[model samples]
Target: MYTKLKDELLVEAYEHAVRSQLDGEFLQILKEELDRRGIIFDEAKKVATADNNKS
Candidate 1:
C-alpha cells in the first residue's frame, strides 16, 4: 500500500516537473531523487500513455 502511494506521488511529481519545464541541475536533482526511490519516469510515462489510450 505504501509503495503504491509512493509510486503515485512520484508520478505526479514527475508530471509536474515536466510541465514546469525543469532543466539542468534542478532536473538532475529530480531524476536522482526518483532513481533513489526506484522509480523510472519513462516507464511511468509509458504506463500513463497506455492507460489514456485505453480510455
Candidate 2:
C-alpha cells in the first residue's frame, strides 16, 4: 500500500541520518570539543535534551 511504502521510506531516511552522524570525523570533532570544554558526552547529551525541552 501507499501508506506502507511511505512509512518504509521514512524509516530508511531516519536510519540514514543516524548513520551519517556516526562518521569518524564527526565523532572526532565531537570528542575534541567535549574534551576542550571539560564535558563528557553524557553531559553534552543532557544539554541537548534541555535545549530540545525548551523548544
Write candidate 1's Cα lDDT for 9-34 as tens digits.
76676678888988767767766766
TM-score of 2: 0.35
> Alpha carbon lDDT of residue 49, candidate 2?
27
Give the whole-model CA lDDT for all candidates, comma-separated.
0.62, 0.45
Stretches of candidate 1 exceeding 4 Å from the true structure: 1-5, 41-55
lDDT for model 2 comes to 0.45
Candidate 2 lDDT at 25 equals 65
Evaluated at residue 42, the lDDT of candidate 1 is 59
Q: How do the predictions measure up, each by TM-score? A: 0.47, 0.35
Q: Candidate 2: which stretches are off by over 4 Å?
A: 1-21, 41-55
**lDDT score of residue 24 within candidate 2:** 66
Write candidate 2's Cα lDDT for 1-55 as tens digits: 3543333343344346557876766566555544444432243333332334457
